[model samples]
Target: MTPSHRSDLLTDALLHYSKKVERKQITLLPQRLAKAAKVKEEARAEFTALLQSVPGTTITAVRGWGEDLVNSLEKTSISLSWEEAYVENLHQLELGRTQLEAPRGGAQVLEVVKRTERARRQVDILERRHRVRQRWSLTTTDSERYLTAAMEKRAQAVLDSVSNLAFERKFMCGLMAKYAEGQTIAKKLSRQIHKLNSKIRRNVKLYNLKRPVIPSSSTLPTLMTFEIAMNPESGLWSQHSVSHDAAFQLKQRLFVLLSLHDRASEEMNIIKRPVCRVRED
Candidate 1:
């Protein structure tokens, strides 16, 4: 082939590649975004489950706060999606309006042909008047102009809504991150409480600690110790609803019960030591 012919071939190849790339982007961008959204939704669901599975008695206040934040995040995501749809529909309407024209005379060529011709004429007039680009389309009526302006305003509003939703999502994420440490502590403490309760259930009854006669009428003091174990009154415990203080309080209560058991058993050696003591450095 001649050099000029090769250059023409290269130019055609470049155009074909550019078109292919454009089509690929159009096809992939939405799919990629959808996959990302799905992943985000799954992550949020998992986070929600984590918050839910956290023992309520453990992190009563913190759990409530986390759940509220998750709900707010979900609402923001939903609102953002709705606004995106609205913007897309309005853009389609704007494009459709530009592509449509008024009906023309009934002739042998048909109404469609007449309308096409009329649209072409309108475009020519608009191009001469406004020096528009090639492939430009216009609507030259007062109503159409007003509708276009309204669509533009609606688009702007949608943009603002999107911005607000984004900020809300960021804020919710930040709050969740900030509270993560507290949740972790709550989760760990809750597990420890569960284990301790099991241990106390097995061991507390073994000792002749004053068994609440009429077990139906009276709560097992040992069982009730679990309530004090949660220790909702203490600042740290109330703040997180689960903490070291709650666990320590439970241990203290258990020790007192055991000490009484030791006294009753005539195990004076066991009673010689302090029931439960915290060492100071």
Candidate 2:
């Protein structure tokens, strides 16, 4: 949808929900503390809800994504240690406009407000730092799941197949090279050996399969292998959430299989073939 269309829909939804639109471009969120990142967001929402439950209190999240907070605030403000920033934002509240609005016994009430705000900002600083790759503490939770022994077995099966195929390719290629080398050595010995060298070359050309690079996610293997001209399709070769690096690792096993076959053939030549074997037909 166009941005204008999306804006209209959002405006309608907010209005339908009895939400007031804020005039300020910059918004500050009340601070939150929670264990997981998901829980952090939930805690921030809960904090805001708790504030809103009071008749006169208001709490809000910062405008836009987490980066928006970093962008709206001055660099020096963010650069301060979390404790320092909390203390500073609180100081601003106590000494700034909020303090002037305070009635009798406002200083005591203001202190409470300041403490909450300061605590909240500490959480925000940690969240903001994590949002940017400024530091990389966050991680994906894909691997942590309920035991799926059956799925694991299937994955192993596919992996084994892929491994065998990969080994076969590499082994065959090496074997072809060896045979070509032997043919070259043999052709130097006799004119009759020239045909054997030619035969090996033909076999090498026919047997060496160049597997096309298809995306792990591509439904049709041939689609990604073909390059597009201008404005190449992006995400075409991107990894499918389903298909993974395991498949690629499996694909490499073909090489070893080919190598084993060549080894067997070499042994047959060394032990099975007799030196006196000559035929006149």
Candidate 3:
């Protein structure tokens, strides 16, 4: 019925949810997955190292060939890294869930979990790039190949750069979306806190007038409400209030969320370099 009681109830519920998340995260893959991933990374690195031994790599004729080899290594690295990322993702998820169950651990755990999710999305992009590269390599013509080399001094440069740009754009888009949501929340909380202040001032005015006032039976605000509010945001949220003894955690959560929003905004606003172009011959 009180703020503290509500927090206790929410804590129990969050612990239960965290346990479920832990169970999901602990779902194991075949033992061979880790070993295969390690071996693939090592092999890719070794092949990349072998590039230094290939002669005439600087020459146009040989450069394309070298590019092909380098691309192959990159593709392998992308594929292997994408697959291996899940291992850490799941590990971090479990760790995050454990932390989520602990007192006042929500902010840190949410950060870790959201980061793992971001890593997974990056892998998704890599997977798509690998597919696109494979498709293009099959269809590239001699003229296109020449243009590629002339524009960037490496046949694969355009492809790699295009892929990188695509990835960056996608990442920026994601940040923009997050920033929008954070802005909305910051506005909402600012309003709520403002409203609370107004209510407190009115209460004081009423008490000073010596008017008999009936207190509302509704439970007071709690840190748990912040968690409820942040359910959609799902990253770095703490249900526990920021204090020597926890009471109102939403203010702290809002501060961090707004800060994150500002950082994303700055990144989104940066000017990107122009894409390489080939002049008509």
Candidate 4:
């Protein structure tokens, strides 16, 4: 046969087989989508857990700060010029404006306002510190360094998980390619066996004088010459070759599945965070 003829025949056969494979893929699509969704959900849950496990939150307590500011303005009140108020309003505004450090202004409102100001100095303190004030309200922005370091480490872990998911997606593409190639190889092998058997049936008399001619469908690789000569071989050679090709293709399918399995196994390697250690390993 001409190369073009062979190519056309293979293309037709591949179209048929590929349609069968594609049908199977269609059925499996929902399964793949479900599994991928599960993986993503699990990763998100772990990310949430990591966020919660951190000592302080990224979200600051700013609403309390606003309320405190309002209270301070109301107490040591400063009113608008359009206001028609009594002397009490002026006294209230003067009281509100007094510095928190003043000798007479060590009241509850002033103390809370100072603590609120200190807490506002760093959001991390606002998150981690439950106490508002004490004998004194003191804060150091130096505490900012530790908060940044801890947050950076957790962010890196989250990014690592994202990378693992990307790698898993790429690895799955390899599986798809491997199965595609295996299908092509199997189809070609089936046709090759079929042609070889047909040739032997037509030309057996040319290859052997003593041997009786065998039929095209009976001369498979596994059949014995005596079986063919005695007419004991059934005309199932093509079917048997198809079965062998299918089985070989099954092994390649399993190999592709195993590759995807490895990606799932390695997923944990990306999400784990190291605990504090006194010594480096």
Candidate 5:
């Protein structure tokens, strides 16, 4: 055969092989695409099923397809809405306020008020004695000195008559009893508040998780944490009724009186250190 003829035959053979390969590839293309699509669909479905099985799974750790599906599942799984939890917490807080504000025995309150007034008068008398002593130190005349001494003696006599140790002891005991009662109530309320706050946080977290496109108007204000709500300066107290304020003030007074009692007991060496049963507020 001629060289040109041989080259032409080789070219025709190569063209035929190329056409056969192209046809084979075109014929298999749909099957390959279908298999690939099936694999993709299976992976997505499997991932979705896994998400559904473990609804509590942290989304950040999940690195795969179907993030939107996971989010949808989360939203659907929320048992309690944030708004409902918030309202429940507010109701619990109101109840606590009411318990604190409820009136105690009228006789006990009257006695405490009367004793408090007498204590104030005693303080005033002591202050007058202190001023008289200062004046006595400055006096130059014997007559003035004699007058100051008589005044001091009379003041001491009045103080002796007014300052009844037994009565004071009874008053301190009453304060201690009130303190214990208030502490118990406060602790119970604090625990309830804490639990409610925890519930609120959990509900809020679940509700907000992977939530898409929340509107500005629909967004709720940030609720105060337990610590913030308990704080005197948080202004949370001002929103409550006057009874709540009075209850708070009463607690403060009880705390102060309890401290004074402890100090007195220590100074007198009559009682050993009192064992505190409750944790400090």
Candidate 6:
């Protein structure tokens, strides 16, 4: 065989082998691209599910959840103001009584009588204004005694309600703080995950790499994983349990208080009934 013929045959063989390899690669290209796309889509769907599962995602929702509690707390605060005013009124009433009863200097009998009458009138005015004549008067009617007792009961109810509300308000405040902290953590985690996903997608598209490589810790910022946040050993879960227990305890206390209030109300109603009189012939 001639040297030129042998050279031509070898060249043809090499060219055929290269063409076969290229054809094989072309045939597999679509499947590889489809697999990569499926993986990316799965990652995106997982992240979306995670974000949806997180509670209190919107500020409006958070605010709305606490709105009723806030209103109750505000209403309960009025009891404190009312109590202070009642105390001040009592002090003023006492001061007026002292002034009315104070001894006057030596004077004529007519002058002494006029001063005593004036003091009696002033005391009467104060008694009417303060509406405590029933409580302060030495001679009290049965009806007046009943009214005084009712007022005292009502005042006690107000104080109890205020105390319960104060405790609930404090618990709510702590719960809200925990919620806010969780929300912040959730937002930060979401941002980090999104950034990581974006980085992977960009790297894959730009380099046409078969597998996306995660940068070393030294090169990239560290991310907190969902697994860590949800782990039972973490502080987040422990705090959740603590809050849940506290809420349960508070609920029990409220139930007990409500039952007691109901019982007290029923007793008051019984007390308010007219007494029955039996005649002995």
Against the true structure, whose lDDT is highest?
6
What would the per-residue lDDT of candidate 3 be over residues 160-202, giving only the tens digit for each residue? 3323222223333444554455687656655554554444344
| Candidate 6, superposed: residue stretches over 4 Å from native | 1-65, 76-138, 142-147, 150-154, 161-281
lDDT of 6 at 109: 40
Model 6, 1-281: lDDT tens per residue?
89999999999999999878656655454445455455445544543454355453443443343454445435343232332333333433544455546665555444655645664555455556767544343233543343333334333333333233334433444334544545876566555545544443443233222112222322221232333322334443343233224444433333333334445445444433321111110
Residues 1-281 of candidate 5 have per-residue lDDT tens digits of: 99999999999999999878766655454455455455445545554554565555534434322343233223222233332222223333434445446686877656555655554454345446445343122234543334334333333332222222112232344444544546876566555545544544443343333122223332222233434333434453354223234433333333343334444434433211111111111
Candidate 4 on 147-239: residue-level lDDT in tens?
A: 333333333332223222222333344435534556876556555545544443433333242112222332333223422422212343333
Candidates 3 and 6 compared: the better one by TM-score is 6
**Each candidate's lDDT (Cα)?**
0.41, 0.35, 0.38, 0.38, 0.40, 0.42
State how far residue 222 of model 4 sits from its true place (Å): 67
Candidate No. with top TM-score: 6
How would you order the candidates by TM-score, starting with the best? 6, 5, 4, 1, 3, 2
Off by over 4 Å in 3: 28-39, 42-281
**Worst lDDT 10-window in candidate 4:** 272-281
Question: Model 1, range 29-88, lDDT digits (tens) per residue?
Answer: 555545545544554554445445435433345444445444533423222332223333
Per-model TM-score versus the true fold: 0.20, 0.17, 0.18, 0.21, 0.21, 0.22
lDDT: the better of candidates 2 and 6: 6
Stretches > 4 Å off in candidate 5:
56-60, 64-281
Residue 112, candidate 5: alpha-carbon lDDT: 53
> Any residue pairs clashing in model 3, and if so which?
241-248, 241-249
lDDT of 3: 0.38
- The TM-score between candidate 1 and the true structure equals 0.20
